[model samples]
Target: MKIKSYFQFTNEQRRGVLSLLLLIVIIQLSYFYWSSSKSTSPSNSNKSWLAMQSVIDSLKISQSSSEGKIYPFNPNFITDYKGYQLGMSLTEINKLFEFRKQNKYVNSALEFQQVTGVSDSLLLAISPYFKFPDWVNQPKKAFSSFDKNTYENKKSIIRKDINEATQDDLIKIYGIGPALSERILKQKDVLGGFVTMEQMESIWGLSPEVIENLNKYFQVTTIPTVNKIDINNLSVKELAKFPYFNYTIAKEIVTYRSMNNGIHSIEDLTKIKGMPNEKIKIIALYLEF
Candidate 1:
């Protein structure tokens, strides 16, 4: 009877318990509905994002194809990086470099092929872009009669002392322009004058072909006298003022000089730690013991 009393509830209490059970069932149904909705929303979002990504990839492909189109460029000026982009091997590039070292140039695409020994397919592909100087492409004028003395006189008149060459003179060279001519003059001013033809290499943007032309027409007939540096006596700061040396190298040189009592010659300077062996000869030109 006591157990039966525990199982039984008052009418109001029974009503309250039924209401609580209904509230819990409603909450559970709402939770399940929202969970299923959230799951479906992500799947739809993923499908939309995938479609957008495919469109973006297609746009990138088209853009890359347009950008990858090669433009016409001078084949003679091709650097290793440029050659690599054009599918040239290291051997072909070296052959071009070797030919250029001899102060020779390939005036035509056919000549370029002969010198570099590039495959015919590569030659055909790149020849269209080979932009040689105007003089190289211009037809040679033929004279009906040849005069030996007149030809010699004209050749003599054509060549000039490089030290006295003005900007006007420099611009007359096929490859050199007003800007390059001005730069050459400016470098000449800074160094007081060029000591050697090799000094032309220091000028920025001077190509091998341009230098060859420069050599053909101009020569250092009179080398300018430079104020020589007293290498053994100068302080690190003073030594650093020399064009070939920087502060670190200057300091090392001074330290070496101190340790050895004094540096005697270019040979002594070369023995110093961190000294550039090849540059010592050039540096020797401006230094006294």
Candidate 2:
């Protein structure tokens, strides 16, 4: 049996096939024309795409701003991690660490930059946060433990424990009166107890002559109880709480401690920048290692 050929189709059937092909072609052309000449995009899709881009840009800006956040802190205490956060390079950080290791101090913005060799822009950016101790802000009369005059008086001078002295007992001293005597007691109370003869010098409104007379008679025996700071755990604020050390000295002490493993002896404290050696002996009396 032979298969029938396409020429066997009737004209009606052929016209039907052509009509079907024409209809399909027309439908595809109309679909393409409408798709290519669209009226507008859906508002939601356009808005959503734009909104996603905006969110991504906002996150990028937030990340950049976060990098600029700088908390106020004492520059002297910057550890390697803290230095890194402040945008310091390893060499700059190491230079700062080296300067501190010498038992030295950075007292100004200029000095900080000099020690660290930080960029001028970075120094300016961070300079406002540089905090030195109050003493660095306003220096006091220079003191020295090696001063020969500190021990100039005769050995025969009478001395009494500052805490044991009564108002009348204090009055017997050449320059002390009832008011002054009370002031001394109050100071002693506030300080726990006098740990050094030099502490009398801190009494308010006392003339130098009067201070000398009082010093001739008064001395420190019993140290009032105090919570000594662990040099290893010291902060500038904590070290300043001691009656013997002021804010400036406290910062120096802590900075020195950080550079070194920790303060090991009174002698170590003397090495701190501008530490009064005479006071250090008295200060040492109250502090543990």
Candidate 3:
């Protein structure tokens, strides 16, 4: 019997194997052509990415512009930081500070301009939102809700010591209500007591009209004794806390005191390097020597 060899292939099987090999070679050639056509050249992709980045940058700019919108605020209370943010020049800011250092308030837009000397364009930009105290622009209707006891309690109205008066007592006066009464009491605490009714003019929201009412109804009969700071004894830090004394002036006062043995009078303080000459008279009210 003739044995079949295990390694030998029949004609049909050999043809099938050859056909399969031909198909694989044809597939590989097509794949090469397809890959060549679709290779990654990223010019268009890069352009799209750059265009997206530009849009994102524009959005950031727009967001920043929106954030710059100014709101209504009191111009009198602008601090150094606020002035800088509002684009005020150093000279203009200094002018405002000098005005405020005298304990005067900016009552109107025209007054603010005169005090700060801001440019006309800048003033137009910011002045629209410059809100002063309520009673300044629109004086409130007089307190019509006065109880019969308000007049009946005769002695209380004659001379209610401003420092001793409670909020209830303060509201009895016309043009004074809850808010104004609290402000008066709070300022009284900070100042120890009102020396002059003029001091009430410095309160944050009190208008001239309201101050007049307060003066009409109440008197600072008992000037609360304060521990007056002796300029010769106070350090620069202590002296600078007073409204009239700034850091530079206070430091100069201390230095001048040390140099000349001690400051003898207000004139000596005014002679200090940075001290305002006119400020000495009012500053003397808070200082002993």
Candidate 2: Cα lDDT at 224: 60
lDDT scores in order: 0.81, 0.76, 0.78
- Tens digits of per-residue lDDT for model 1 on 57-158? 999999988874677777767899989988899999999999888866687888988999999999888788877654456454465577988788667765
- Off-target runs (Cα >4 Å) in candidate 3 are 1-65, 75-128, 140-157, 171-183, 201-205, 265-285
Can you tell me which runs of candidate 2 are displaced by over 4 Å?
1-160, 171-174, 177-179, 202-204, 215-217, 220-227
Q: Could you tell me the TM-score of candidate 1?
A: 0.53
Error of 1 at 187 (Å): 3.6
Better of 1 and 2 by lDDT: 1
Candidate 3 or 2, higher TM-score: 3
Against the true structure, whose lDDT is highest?
1
RMSD of each: 7.1, 14.0, 10.5
Q: Order the candidates by lDDT, highest first.
A: 1, 3, 2
Candidate 1 error regions (>4 Å): 1-10, 25-63, 66-85, 88-105, 131-166, 179-183, 196-283, 287-289
- Write down the RMSD of candidate 2 (Cα, Å): 14.0
